[model samples]
Target chain A: MDLKQSARDLAIEYLLQEIKKGNLKAGDKLLNERKLSENLGISRVPLREAICTLSTLGILEAHQGDGTYVSDSYSEIFSNIIKKYGIFDRSMVDEVFEARSLFEADAARLAARNHTEDDLVKLEQALKKHENALTDYYEEKLKDKDMMELDTEIHLGIAASSHNNFILEIVKSIRYVTLQQDYFSEQYTLDHEHFKRSSIMHREIFNAIKEKNEDLAYKKMQEHINEIRLALDIESIRRDIK
Target chain B: MDLKQSARDLAIEYLLQEIKKGNLKAGDKLLNERKLSENLGISRVPLREAICTLSTLGILEAHQGDGTYVSDSYSEIFSNIIKKYGIFDRSMVDEVFEARSLFEADAARLAARNHTEDDLVKLEQALKKHENALTDYYEEKLKDKDMMELDTEIHLGIAASSHNNFILEIVKSIRYVTLQQDYFSEQYTLDHEHFKRSSIMHREIFNAIKEKNEDLAYKKMQEHINEIRLALDIESIRRDIK
Candidate 1:
């Protein structure tokens, strides 16, 4: 029932409205502080806070001694913001897996159709990294962190090969959440058996993409994610009982 | 390659690292500004900017007489930030549609299985609103703005019924972008036929969800989104030729 609007939010909302109304536009310099604050009918403190917020989000760019201007680099900003803050809860684990199952599987299919030579090279390299990480884990030479990162790298590589920015960003955001699993829960120990099995699945997914077998790539990726999800489902159910 | 980190970014990163290392906990008040700024080897100016930025994003909260505190409300913060800046480019139209096709179809299926009575009531109301908007549009009484909003409401309502916060937030972000289609392009005019057809699809999808027909709900939502994508593809192709 708290309908209060913070001063900073009001200022931010005003600027967004101007942008939406076409009065403020990409690359357009904002009005100087005194004039803007006067026009907004608020003091400069909240106004400055609003600008800082927008600039941090990369929606606005500020040049020292010049002024702030609307930014045209929306794509990168969008990716960075989502990657940094999109997933933050332990309860969101199942949702993340569900999202990855749908999006990453489709990404694999698209990669099979659209992957460039460079993408194939990257995917191969990522797969190699996963295998090495798995070996190192078995030999007690690597930590679970390396295994998790390498695994994610392969999935992100496939998302890149899909040539769809949305998939790449979405995968990155959700994968980031999964990587932080160790941060939230007891350190997520990667067993040698699980690591070995994951490596095998990654190899199969990579080979499918390499061979341009779209359906196989999609199915393999789905199975791999589904396998992981099964383990997570069991863990969550155990937690509930506890 | 600009490798230089801005002062504000440095401060923000330092704070995030502290949180990650468990040195700072949610609801814990931040160190006093003077002490924190000294610790970071930076002046208070950029530090304040960092705090302001996080506060605006809801990652941190600032109280006037008290101090800034790490916030536990990360889910709401994640949703707000993405909804505000996630989709920012004209080139992203195709990507948005592709994401929607994958996520929303799955969400519809989940909704069929998981929706509650309240969810059904909300969805029904959204459907009625859409029908009314279409009627108003046909009668020359409604603007494209109302129609656009009403249309997105139904999709968002379906996403809510999925009972997955991730799906709800994702749908909200993407749909917010679509709503700005008019802001980015020359106003998007919804023709009578397109509106009518969309309304029909919404009703069918709603019925499938209401009847708890998971596969049918998924199929209907996919068909609905694919139909929209087909038109978009043709438009993009035409634009390329021109």
Candidate 2:
């Protein structure tokens, strides 16, 4: 176990150095497993584990039919690492939300300034999915999980439109953390009323971004996050009273 | 070797689970090594390595003589982990700086709203050290490293005053990544004129935060980061021309 773990670390460290030295680069495909393991003088198992870890960290992307390519996006990397280690817990929910509020507010402002037509198309598509989910929740009895995931997609789309990978990654991490929290899920169950409110706010924020209204985007995003945060606070207060 | 590595990982995972379950907590000291090793059914070596890893990740702290305690700051943890794994490199410097600009601008605004008197004292002390470094740059000839470290201290102090751990941790991670970049240090040599300009801006930021001027604090921080970024851009362009 020790050897395998150290070998995995060694493999990961070696690949990172290769990336750092520009021997490996973004979009470069990985060597085959047997060859890479032979080159590293490690067995296949640890090398595979290393690759899995890197993939989770957004440093690599695996294609369905081809092979893994270096992505090096760094978005979702930090929080994903923490999540993989199982260190994130309920106590972190508030901090994650607080960070999300500030991050997405700025992201909205940046999106207003920097988003391209393609970015707008992607965001609009995400918003459309969210609205469809809301309708399905009331009509076809859609699962809360699907709505929640779509909700996150809309937020992430805005972050991506900001043309800032760092902001996008941070927002991704925040969403990942909150999504993992049990109480967050329980408190944020996608009831129609809650989904309706979120849908309306998401549209307003999206429109501000589309119209290039930086101030309005920032303000609306802040309001949207604050409403959710307030709901979380109320749930916790009620739990305490109980 | 495989056994040792897995043991370390098992120890880390176990501790993380404990923290997540509220069985361990921030500020809680650990059992002695022998007891912990016995409890985990691992040898002392892997257990120690696990402790070391956690300490590097800011999830644990080891005193000079006392046993290790859980810190759980999360600040510096993510970047420190990436650094440990050799994942961070020169390619990340620009993104780190861009994120720092947006994060610190909001951090300054939060500091203006949240800073206590003690926070002001820390900021003032950090500023004083920066000014001293500036004076020594001309007189006693301070090394650029000392000046740069002090410069980071001032910025981190402002982030710390923001009263948001998530913001503090993100800012900490940004500083950690930039500090590790070889080109960053080479490009950011603290010439007297540069130090003087930075000193002036740092003081203005500190004063704005002290006076509880959130808007001014945010604006000043934005200006400060933009100045540094502009200098960086010019230097890169010059290097490219060369």
Candidate 3:
């Protein structure tokens, strides 16, 4: 390994531990390059790289004359690190699923309550794409990947229509973080019945939104997320992990 | 400015424009170091630095034996940049308000439907502290600061009691992102009148939770977030920015 790379990793590890211990906070400018070098026993070159890395992850900030500061709090830092560990890690998946359930449920409720005509059009367009992907049903090659992508599109559409950028951003991030695991797999191909059920559920959610019934929307959204949970066989996975 | 940093800013600015124009995407790796230097008319050092910065942002990822690939989609990149900007510019307050409105409303609904006796005690404790802060009605001199903090504390308390870590984490992160607005100036001094009213609202929310009336609890939480909306005045600020 390169010296600078090792040094950069060290800086991240040390800073992560400190933040985890609550030794740092937002706006607390970080140590200067020279001082950080001295403190970490690494050269300024690698320390700067590490600081810059964390800065990108939103855990640290760089000021022209001042210094780097720990920016994000522990939980935020944990979220980023959790991404690095990948989604198949049962705990992370559980966390993501749990988070998604909360978000999607709320999103559905909001969309149902406040969806405008425009929101409805966008949602219908997304549903059309999902339906189009189903045309390849007999051809197993495209079934799995297409379904996942379609599912993401539908969810993203719902989040977008809810008019909440923050939730959309987080949900988008969640999708990115879990891309390798869920976006493409043979499951959609193998579980044809599940795909049919999911299609019906999507249609039901759309109808609920169209009817502007927040309760039905929330319930359907919850059921949809729970369906994914069950399809992933997460309950068994969670038990196995424990 | 350092040469590499100057190079990085230029690269970032360049790449951001490309992303905005929809010219880049995931899995699209850039040219080799030598080729990129030739193309951009810069030395390898600056090019490498720029790529590293983008890489750190998770927009690009460098493969040891391969090239640099855009690790994120354009929307993901934009979201990160926007989120960071919100924090640095203090617009995160609005972001927090939007998210909290949704989360709190949902949490209230859930808590009312799901709260146990233990949950009641915890909610009661938070309410008590809120009342205590009111009695100590020394005007909190800082305006922007301390606004969402206890709000977050109360939120976390409710989320924790609601027994939903997903809600807890998102709410936690929303607070985390906004806290990036370094506590610069405190906004309003505690007007005894205002504090008294706020205390009453807290009590109202408490009573709703105690009563386990999901609709009432949700309505109360919605009103609470609106009150905070006025306190933060996020929507107007966003309008002003645009």
Candidate 4:
């Protein structure tokens, strides 16, 4: 490895070690450029590059004049990476949906286990929108776009309610990537069945949550995805790619 | 809902429209900071933040002096996000094996269908490394630590030799996330069974490639990952996670 690689590796190694050791607390600021460069025994370039890279990872937060601090916002960093990388081709959409099926199933199960009053209110609100949208074709398109976001809101709400940051963050990251993919946001008009099935799924999922039935919630979530799978043949996605 | 989110939502909506409408092309330079800020009627602070956020998503690439450009490096950006999201968790070790098994099985099948002398040589070199690692545990640690990089070399070699960037890059991203995860580097004695089965798997995969037995090659790849599932356990991971 040349000087640049060596410098970068050293810096990365040092920082990772510090993170692992808990010397770098979530909100602790790092040493400034002058000291950091001297300590790494390298010039400023590679050190800055590594810092920028870590900052991008949400491990560091650079606040202009305020220096770089270890960050608490893992999700923001995660979304940043997803926005950049998770753009997919048509066939990859099938794989993405497969992942989503598994992810949302778990999210629903967890949400069911921990639905607070606030969570119930949000869920009900999303469901009400679906019902209104189903009443008219023109209104449906206007609401269909927001439907996915609301759907995401419920799933995210469940993950948030699960009180597991690790799983919640994972679920959120997966959804973010899935939504950014070719398949998830593909232009579509909702048929009566599409709207009816969606409303039913949410209601069933909500009932499961209200009953605090994890298994029932998970199953319904899977069923919800299976419904989409039946309508949108995975193989048909390959045709779109070509 | 506030200024920051308003800016973010508008930026994403505008960019998505541009992407869909062909108003923005890959590698197109984004409007300069002043112009974009002016157009959006947002302060330089939020506009810069939005552009930086988009750049982090891999949609835009801000070259220091050259202005921000739409990225040609989406694959890397995507891979970085996947890695950052902990998509390579202990759970994914199993999933990676499943995905790799499916992917490499296809890759081997493809290689068998179209193996040149060079492809065969590289495959042999990969097998040799597997063999050498079993005998030389220290080197294996380094190789295994960054196994995705090595795996990428062999897998991409197969995909590239078959001349499919789309298949190559997607599989390449999904395959490497586990190897790039911090969990991979945590101290663990190499499982002898893992090394043994891996050796057997590679030999069979290579033979299928050499003989052009697509079915056999693919099956061997699947068998390889199936064995890997039994060979590694990562509950030790929970201890290392912060």
Candidate 5:
């Protein structure tokens, strides 16, 4: 490795050690550059490079004219990475859906097991919003973008209900990536019948979670995602035939 | 959002769009800063920041005296983020194991469905290595580090056999995080009996894959991971009681 790269890696490793040791924490201001560089026995240049790299990774935040601080969430860093490198070919769409299905199914199972009353209420509201969007779409009063947002909101609510912050963050990041790709590629056509079916699937998943049926929740979520994958695959085939 | 942050986001989004359009590819050198910045309607400063961000994320590589190019694998980026932020409390260890179990079980299923003769050969070799390590441990000749490496290699081989790049990347990242945490905490004592059990589980999983039994592979892998989780939980409780 290059000297600068090695230095950056050392600095990052040290920072992670500090965080693990509870010497540094989320939202805590880091030591000043001079002090930190001196303490790490590295030059200011490599230390700054490491800081910048961490800031870019969303583990650290640098405020203008203010000291840097550890970030409270690594979700944004994850999202940033997803946005940058998650461009997939048409063939990879199924892989994306497969991965999403795995995540959502597991998230649903966890949500069924762990959801609080508050989480149930949130899921109910999200389901209502999704139902309303589906109704509007059926009436020709909602655009695809509105429907997509509502769909994402409902899934995000389920993921949040899982009560596992790590899984929640990852599901959210994957959702963002898939949504961005769909938006950019105009991948899915608005099918009224498919929308109706998806609404029903959403309700089934919600009810399963509310009833605390972990297996049912997992099955419903998995079936819902698999349906979407099938639809996309058919759409791609149709486009190719065109 | 901060102006600079927004600018970087914009540049990153535009670059992603370009990649989706096939204007850039893995190992493709980015356009010169002057031309690219002007084309993207951004100043060079923010553009450079975005480039630096991508480089840090392992999506791009900045070669000394050479222009930057897209990276072939995004696995490094995922591993980097996991390494930086996967510090969890003892309670969260089960959650981590749950997530890993989900990933690894699915990977095992896929491996059973997709593994070629070559893939099976690799997996068998990995299993053999793991079995050797287990024997060494039984004889008090193997270190924790050696055991961990062997364990990771076995899992990585299974993931590779899955033939899904995305799942492989995720499994690799999760393994890196868990191994790092285990190393740092000395969380798992060297239990000869546990090692023997694990070696048996590994063999069962390998046989399932070799037999092309997807469901069996999934079940065995899931059981193996849950066993590990149970052991860790017990270990943590014992430590608490101490």
Candidate 6:
């Protein structure tokens, strides 16, 4: 590597080391540039570049006149990353769904094993909200945004029930990207039939988790995603024919 | 949200819109601060804040004195995000492995369907290198880093064979995080038996891919990961007992 690249790498390594050692943490404001550069034995130029790199990675937040801070939420970082990448093409969308299937299936399995009473209550509440949203939509009383938010809530509730922070964050990221795309895409639509089928599938998944049936939960979650994938594929084909 | 947050959001939305319209491309140098701010009808402070946010998210790169540019690669952004998050605990490790299982299985399935002659050649070359590295290690002639690199190369080759750039990139990101953690962790080690089993599993996966047996390839890939997970679990248990 050239001198510039090496310097940036050194800076990255130093910062990561600090984070790993707990010298830096999420939501912690970084020290002033001059002090940090001096402490790391690097000049201000490379130090700034490194900080800029970290910021671009969504690991740090820079507020004007407020200094830089480590990001407290991985979900925000993930949503930003997805938006930046613009993963909306058909193939990319398919890949995202594939990822979601895996993540949610594993999440369902874990939730079956790990959920507490509070989690069960939250899951039921989310499910009820989703069911009510679907009912309102079918009755022509709900907006798309409301249904979308409710749909996201139900999936996120199951993810949270897994009791694994990492899984929760990953699921949130995937859901954010998928929902953002759906919200913005003109081709995305939810008819009564799709909503009806989706509601039943959601209930089955919820029940499987509630019963603590890990295998059944995993299978149901996978089937739920596969159905969605099939619906998306059909829509794409219809668009193509149109 | 506060005024500052709203301004930042506006800036982010504006930039993302520009990107989606192909007005901005990867590696394209961003316009000067004054010009961009003026064009957006926003002041320099908010525009700069927006740029800083993009920079932190790895969507843009800032050279020392040169103008900022869109990142050429998303993998760099992903690596930075992973490092910043520092997902190293047991549950996080399991989550990462779950992600890998999903990603690699999908990649393997796609590779089975999509591999061209050239891809097969590359895959064979990577597998051969891995096999050689394992042999050398068992003969006490190789270092851990060498074997690790070879192992990564084999998986990356399979990902590349999938013929999907998005899948390839996601797999690369997952592997980078997992390998980085393994490289730095004192708990990570590979014994001869583990290498032997891994070699067998890799060949099985390769053969399944070569034969265009998608189901078999997926199954083998999942099995390969499960074996690794089992080995890690066993090691953790042993550590706990000791």
Task: Name the top TM-score candidate.
Answer: 2
User: What are the clashing pairs of model 5?
Assistant: none
lDDT of 4 by residue, A92-197 (tens): 5554555456556766776776568887887777677666666663444554446666667666776666544444655676666555544443443323356567
Ranking by TM-score: 2, 5, 6, 1, 3, 4
TM-score of chain B of 2: 0.71
2 or 3, greater by TM-score: 2
Q: Write the per-residue lDDT of candidate 6 for residues B52-119, one digit (tens) a residue.
A: 65665567788877888988754665665665664443455665666677668878988998889998
- Tally clashing residue pairs in candidate 3: 8
Q: DockQ of every model listed?
A: 0.22, 0.28, 0.12, 0.06, 0.28, 0.17
Off by over 4 Å in 6: A1-74, A86-90, A183-187, A230-242, B1-74, B86-90, B164-166, B183-187, B230-242
Candidate 1 structure, TM-score to reference: 0.66
Model 1, position A198, has a per-residue lDDT of 81
Model 2 agreement with the true structure over B39-134: per-residue lDDT tens digits = 999999778777765654568887767888988664556666545443322235555566777789989998998888999998899998888767
Query: Which regions of candidate 5 are displaced past 4 Å?
Result: A1-76, A83-90, A183-187, A233-242, B1-76, B83-90, B183-187, B233-242
lDDT of 3 by residue, A98-163 (tens): 667767887787778667899899889888877777767646656566677888888878876666
Error of 2 at B27 (Å): 15
| Residue-wise C-alpha lDDT for candidate 5, range A1-242, written one tens digit per residue | 67867777789889978877889988999999999989988888678767876876778899778989998865566666755565432245556676788878989998998899998888788878888777677787887667878888889889888877667777877786666566222355534466678889999999999999999999999999887765554456334421
TM-score pick, better of 3 and 4: 3
Tell me candidate 3's TM-score on chain B. Answer: 0.53
Question: What does candidate 4's lDDT look like per residue over B37-152, in tens digits?
Answer: 78877677556555655564566776766887887655565455554444232354444454455455555666677667987787778767656666555445455554534544
lDDT of 1 by residue, A38-143 (tens): 9988888888888888887777888776988998754345445554554432355556666778678878987898799999888888888788666667887876
Q: Which ten residues in a row have the lowest lDDT in candidate 5 chain B?
A: B183-192
Better of 1 and 5 by TM-score: 5
Query: How well does candidate 1 score on lDDT at residue A221?
Result: 92
Summarize candidate 5's per-residue lDDT along B155-206 as a digit string, tens digits. 8999888877667777887776666556223455534366678889999999
A112: Cα error in model 1, Å? 2.7
Q: What is the lDDT of residue B99 in candidate 1?
A: 71
